[model samples]
Target: MRPGVSLRTKIYGLVITIAVIAFACSLWLSIDNTRTYLNEQMQSHAQDTATSLGLSISPYMDGNSPMVVETMVAAIFDSGYYLSMVLTDADGRELLTLENPVEIDGVPAWFIRYFPIQAPTQLTDINNGWQMTGQLAVTSNPGSSHDKLWRNARNNGYLSVFIGGVALALAHLILSSVLLPLHQLEQQAMAVTHKQFATITPLPSTRELNTVTQAMNSMVTNLQTSFTQMAMHAEKLSSDAFIDPLTKLGNRRAFENQFIAQVGEMQDNDLATLGLIQLPSLQVINAKLGYEAGNGYIRQASEVISQALAHRTSGTLYRTGGSCFFFKVASAGATVEELCNHLHEQFSALYSSHYSEGFANIIATSYDNKQQLNPLVSQLDNLLTRESSTTGTGLVYWAPEQESQLQHANGLHQWGEIIDDLLASNQVTFMFQPVLACEGNQTSENVLYFELFSQFLQDGIPLANSELYAMAELLNKSLELDKMLLQQLLTIGDFKRDVTVALNITHQTVHSAEFGEWLEEFYQHNASNLPTLVLEISETAILASIDSSIRFIQQVKACGIQVCIERFGSSFTSFKYLRGLDVDYLKIDGSYISDLDENPGNTHVIQAASQVGHGVGVKVLATHVENETSLRLLEELACDGVQGNFIQPTKKLAPYSEKKQCQYWPI
Candidate 1:
């Protein structure tokens, strides 16, 4: 029964048990002493009474005065101390006797029965001039003695009970103070195991308990530090293991991990796809452009591919080799045809613009119908081999005619026509999401600016910007589309003054060296009418070719326009480029923002990234800050800015107004 009792209860119980035993002993001694002393007193009283009554009667015995002796007995009995008095002659003849039953008042009968007080009886001879006449016996009544015994025992018992109760209460109070620290220690241990890393302050006054608690605080601090470092190192190991050494894209090994993991998780009602884009001309490009230039071009092309597929949260891109890239998309937003077209449109033009003769091919395979990845991978292998041999120069979207690559050129032409029609309209839509300052900049005056999210209108509906960028790549009009968006922004008359807006740019816009030269000349003419503009790209884009990204960043920064990498850590990023690239901000991926507080894995990663970013003078901001809890946690992690629904809702794309009288604010 006591097994489930708490430690505090057990401590109090032990103290109470000892107190009860001591109380019992003390009460018994008090009762026993009172009884013994009472019994001796009673015996003395009986002897004195018998001797006095016998001497008084001896005078009467000498004269044979029976009436006098009887009178004397009556006097003694009426005194109320004796129970009875008896008398007899020398020859043993019966004599007159006086007796009465003794009854003590107030004391209970049961008490007397349990703790009986037996008084001694005494006998004396009544003598006449040295001759014995008769004997008298006197027995003292024990009623008074019994009453005193019970009163003494009960008073001592009551005192013992009161003292025991007080002692138990005091012991419990003391134990509570002593064991309070133990309760805290238990809680602290549980919290530490869960990675909370909490500490207990104000050590217990008990010397031993204080020492233990202090030690615990030190241990918990060390353990928390160790856990955080371990998490960072583990994340680093996973990332470094999966990333390509040169391009920083997911390596072949990473692709295999994602492939198998997705295959195991794919359900019958799942949408998963595989794609492979191979640059069969990497060696030729390297020979034409130096090996370093060739590696840079590969990285640039990878950036375009990654940006095109950024809409897929569960998909991954891998640089299988210097000339080949592979991707396995999960829960694709578009069809296999659309993916192939997008990849082709983005990378083919990018390759052509970089090398003397551009060459790239794309093959997209749908794995939803296939039950396993092994067969899908085999199919991709066959397509790559076929593309390397005789596939047409442009995009080969998977068509009904599987054996021939050019059989799908007709579909590609149709997509090209759609993109042509969309661009001809010249209408662009733009959205704004405020990048809230994390370091106490709340008011409009303190806000840095809103990030401008722009898209091209197609079929009377605004498609995502990546779609437009991808299509523009295939049509060789991506630079024209980017310029058109900037032209529309420059023409905005109602845009608030003293407020800056940042634009997220595409890889194709900057891949062509001619675009950088063109932008440098175009800005000289248009910089006067443009608002404060900050162009943004993804880390994947910059990592593609640092040389190109750096050249483009410097060209734009020279025009008084800043550059940033949005969704920063989604790809494999290296800090070495920070020294060369002049980026103003690094926006962390949203995936990490949503998981903070609940799991410190993202926190540790963000902390490590921010530390590095800060050391290089680049401000770190987090995107997708959902709630106050997440926002507060990011603040604690020392982020410079945050953007999400919690910070500000994204505004609808406002159409460009051409009529209002306005001078575009100074860039």
Candidate 2:
């Protein structure tokens, strides 16, 4: 793009040009008219002097009064108006002569050279008693006339310049006032590009500019309305698929998704605690006081547990069944026994106040490490039922073994030290999983990019990447960990030259100003050797600090990096917020893609997500496509890409050379 001159400057130039020309013409005309008038007056004065002196000299025409004539001529010449005078006899012989040199003061020599004044001479015949004796000539000096014209021209020039300067300054002020609205309109348009809509207030009074301002305001209003509607529709679809309608919590589907993604796979020495709350008197309460009463009880219980979970960031509450609520908290916080006991106290208070004869129960259990999702929930349910049958409600119980408690504490302590060492060492291991494009009926040979997963090792044992992040977050080491991951990824020369790579970033990293500044500098220095880098942020992380995340995404994208929102649709946060984001891809959470062929509800959710993404010109991708049916389903739903075991399992990222191209999955 070429540089543009401002309207103000252009107008100023035009006004100045016109003013200069007009002033020059006006000054020239004034000086010309004054000079003509001065010449006429000088001529009239010289003629009058000559005629009067001729009569006076006529008496001396016979040579007897020559002295008198000479005296009169000399007296007139001495008046400084006439340059010279001569008296002659009737026979044309010279009689008396008077002459004076012409000189002018207070005017420049150059001015005289450029503008010369013309002088007129007058002649009369001298007569004595009706006889012509001699002739008299009177010539005017042009020095005084030139001096007068120069003074007038100089004064007029000064006045014109002062007036022109004042006019220009006033014109500048007027132009700035007139174009103020245009500047506002420009800023408004730029704001819209960043998804910030601002309207102009106190509209400009100019007819044309006012019309334009109104039009811009109307257009912004329409866009904001449309963007809001699109977001709301997408959010509704997300809620329908995963949210429990009555309790406003995660439904069974949401719970299953959360379990598989976060809880199903656990690390050694990491505790997994599950809590189940059952409203045992729900049916009896409904029979006596109606379903509304039963709903009230359920809502009350959900509220109690919701409030308890609020104090713990890692806790997740779900309405897994009609009368059963499930929750999970991180291992580093309050033990399972304390949580269960506290809930029991709350439940006991509710039972005493609302249902004097009815009862409720709470049961919980903790495993030392990873366990099957179904068996764990079933075991908790069986324990709750056995307790209710034996003790008859109002009971709070837990699994007998508390061995996981000590192991979890020890593991947390070990993790803190290990994470500090890893951060200090500035190293990490990376595994690459390919995200391949989805083309209908054809196995796509094209690899969209490779997503990187980071892991930490302790004494040759691979620790859970998820737990490491959890611990890092707890210890405020998330920023350091993310930095190490990016630094390590950049060392792989093969990926930089041949393909793209996507790396996950934590919420802490996304919000940290230090991290943002570091990333910007890193990209600037390594841009040439950098791959088509894509930063993958979780859907929840963005929703947590939406404004900052948007800034971060925009900042990185300006540096030529791509962004993806991974684990999308897992959170019930309205998808409307996506309209405000500038993203390249939306990686649908694996839970939604896992049973795509069987889960009809998730199909609608994914379809809505795909439509929303495409609406904003972003590609939608499905994660964890483990089977042919799911892959076919995703393709039918218009998913642009897919990633999971169906394509290829994650493998260690190895160093490569320029001669050998990186291997891709089978087409």
lDDT of 1 by residue, 1-667 (tens): 1137777767767787778778877887787788889888888988888889888888788555767878778987888787777777787776866766768888887877766777678888778887898888888888878778888888888888887888777877888888899989988875653225678988899999999999999998876555555445634854765578787777875565446544433333344557888776678778887898788778877888878777543357888776888886553323446767877776556665555445666786655434455676677778767765655444354433321222122344565676667657776666577776766522122456678766555566654343334445555776677777777876674666677788767667766687778778878887766667878886766766778887787678777787778756656544444544557788876645654555455576678677655644577888776677877778888888887666666665354453233222212
Highest lDDT: which candidate?
2
Residue-wise C-alpha lDDT for candidate 2, range 566-613, written one tens digit per residue: 888777777777766878899988878776767756887788888777
Clashes in model 2: which pairs?
90-133, 231-576
- For each candidate, what TM-score against the reference? 0.44, 0.67
**Pick by TM-score: which candidate is best?**
2
What is the C-alpha local distance difference test score of each model? 0.68, 0.77
User: What's the C-alpha lDDT at position 241 in model 2?
Assistant: 72
* Model 1 ranges with Cα > 4 A deviation: 1-10, 62-68, 92-114, 190-196, 243-255, 264-667
TM-score of structure candidate 2: 0.67
**Deviation of model 1 at 414, angstroms:** 36
Model 2 lDDT at residue 450: 89
